[model samples]
Target: MLFKFRRHWETPWEVVDSKAVKPVYMYYDDEDSLDIVAVSDADTRGTYVFEVNHLTRTALRNAVTFSRQQLIHQVAKKGFNVLVLESWRLTIFRRGKSHRVEVMYSGRPAEALGKLPHLPPPPFMDVLHEFM
Candidate 1:
């Protein structure tokens, strides 16, 4: 099989919990994947890490086909009792007895809408120290 890949930006993101909220910065390696760097104003539940196998064609498409409304229901069908997903390619794995529910997302609004509005920065801010 043949494959093609492109790199996204190394940008800061926001993570909002029920009572507390903070910012998280994500960086990309030349390896075609991103890594979590820091969370502002609050500590992470732990150093949560995710290495997306963008090559997983089937899995990636299956994840994206759900309607905006069905996204939550599809995730619940897996196992998570309570779930939260970010706007971008960040997913949260919630605990379950035999397994956990995984929410997979990627912020490709431009790809989805063909054109998007010029949105402002997140409420919180952080910097991306370029990997040297």
Candidate 2:
């Protein structure tokens, strides 16, 4: 039946509830420093906005993990555009108290590693489809 077929092919984007999910962020600064902050209700719940340092191996790995989790939740393992995935980034505030927003997801593991200068891609990409 058409209903069954549609259900079979549907890709579920699992968006976390703003109230229940506690989003977290790990930022890297230029001096090999890592700063992590959890996104609370006072801040944007599901959005990451800041200029965290992306130039460390661990930082890059963490960023990939963060994005992968969200993407898996959103796309439900139906597969994603590699090009699109490689183009995503997590943006954040720089040197001001201002809370302006931006996106820095490059979807590419290589790009993330580049920021660190010496690192491999996160390990989670290997099992991205298992959850779907």
Candidate 3:
């Protein structure tokens, strides 16, 4: 087996949530974002860490999704209920015989002033729900 191979960046593409509103809201850039400030307590450059032996082919499409969700959970622990002007980078590589996916996201963390609104899921989300 080759010790080194060219790395690819595609696995991270499948695990993305484009929803505009949620408990931990996400925005790609300042052009369309909320009025919030960046909090320093949260981990901005969160890395995806996992064991290769536990990797499964079916889970590949959801790896980045998991990473981002984990980051949000951690930030919430720090009192951040929302994130704005967010961006993420994805990486795909091989560990031994398995292909692994990772995601690192950066965003301005903020606490919503009042009760965060929780609207019904977008109509388009029904397509996703059906697959579950």
Candidate 4:
């Protein structure tokens, strides 16, 4: 019998905070996995964390795949957080702000793209409903 071992990728946490919304910590793995942790209280006692796998990532990417103009319009019309993750970078948009982070895989650095032009409805809505 043969056994296969998978490599583990660790992403350092990046935190974003604002007076209007809860603080959010975002990070990604080498396999295109995204982890989002939202802190609900000032004391960081209550929290909600979402871990998205490759399948969910694919669905999200497909759902938001739109022309630049279309994306800008959709984002302006709907207020929701959007995340785009590629092999080398992770981009996030929330509350009209955008940010990009470089991703390193197996200790190799990768290039990052600019902020996406548009926003799509949150792809994790269904998963969120399950917990509520």
Candidate 5:
């Protein structure tokens, strides 16, 4: 899916390929900013931090239809710790202090992560069951 970024002091929007890297932490601030820290290179533990303005923030907010804390709570209710969105799949991870396990939901490449717009609908029990 396409992710748009409006950087601070920049009027034009910057488009990015969300699937290029796996995002580990994502937050939307009250100042109309969206902060995302992704694992750019797992081998080096490198990260890419993107701080974008209101437009991008609104796009993401509309996509998820929920607040950051709500999303985390929803995922926690299912016993998952991390959520990764790829071009072709949604991968949910269960992490421990040292190790992590994952479960993937395939198809729906166009759908944004956290926004499960498929049949048999929301509260994604099928996907959540994988975590258990």
Candidate 6:
């Protein structure tokens, strides 16, 4: 824990809400670069913040996909395939006309020992090359 640039599922904030529920940052690696040794689940604090309560103006991307599909079905029944540091948040309350919707989903659960290598693409994507 000496250095980190940000890769807790890498989500700064960008939910246009066309049916929001977008979070599953593929595979994470902020310089960890595919070392493959993940077995993180330190005594059950692996991280998870599920909260989906709806009833606002109706239609909230299906309550954020029913709270991210019940947090990926309880993290794949606790066996975990891969779910690194994902993040999500969206809250609203009015009360004047009965409005209250929340969709908070966090993540951090891993058990990857195989098949997870495919993440090299960041370095600004080579400045998005396009010289034509």
Tell me each candidate's TM-score.
0.18, 0.26, 0.49, 0.17, 0.18, 0.27
User: Each candidate: how many clashes?
Assistant: 1, 23, 0, 1, 0, 0
True-vs-predicted CA distance for residue 17, candidate 2, Å: 30
Candidate 6's TM-score reads 0.27
Give the better candidate number (4 or 5) by TM-score: 5
Clashing residue pairs in candidate 3 are none
Ten residues in sequence with the least summed lDDT for candidate 2: 15-24
lDDT of 6 by residue, 37-97 (tens): 5555532222222232444332444554465557656776878655565555555444333
Model 4, global lDDT: 0.28
- What TM-score should be assigned to candidate 4? 0.17
Residue 48 displacement (Å), model 4: 8.3
Candidate 4: clashing residue pairs, number: 1
RMSD of each: 19.9, 18.2, 9.4, 20.5, 20.1, 17.3
Name the candidate that leads on TM-score.
3
lDDT tens digits, residues 71-107, model 1? 3344334432112222323232322222111333322
lDDT of 3 by residue, 19-129 (tens): 221223344345333444545654364777443455443353355456557766877888787664355554555644655456565555666554555422212223233
Writing each residue's lDDT as its tens digit, candidate 4 over 1-132 gives 397654456343444321111222223445233333331121111111223333234432333232222433343343322333211112222222332222111111122344433333423324322211
Which of 1 and 4 is the better model by lDDT? 4
lDDT measured at residue 103 in model 4 versus the true structure, 0 to 100: 17
* Native RMSD of candidate 2 (Å): 18.2
Q: Supply the TM-score for candidate 5.
A: 0.18
Model 6 Cα shift for residue 91 (angstroms)? 4.2
lDDT of each: 0.27, 0.33, 0.49, 0.28, 0.28, 0.47
| Cα lDDT, model 6, residue 61 | 45
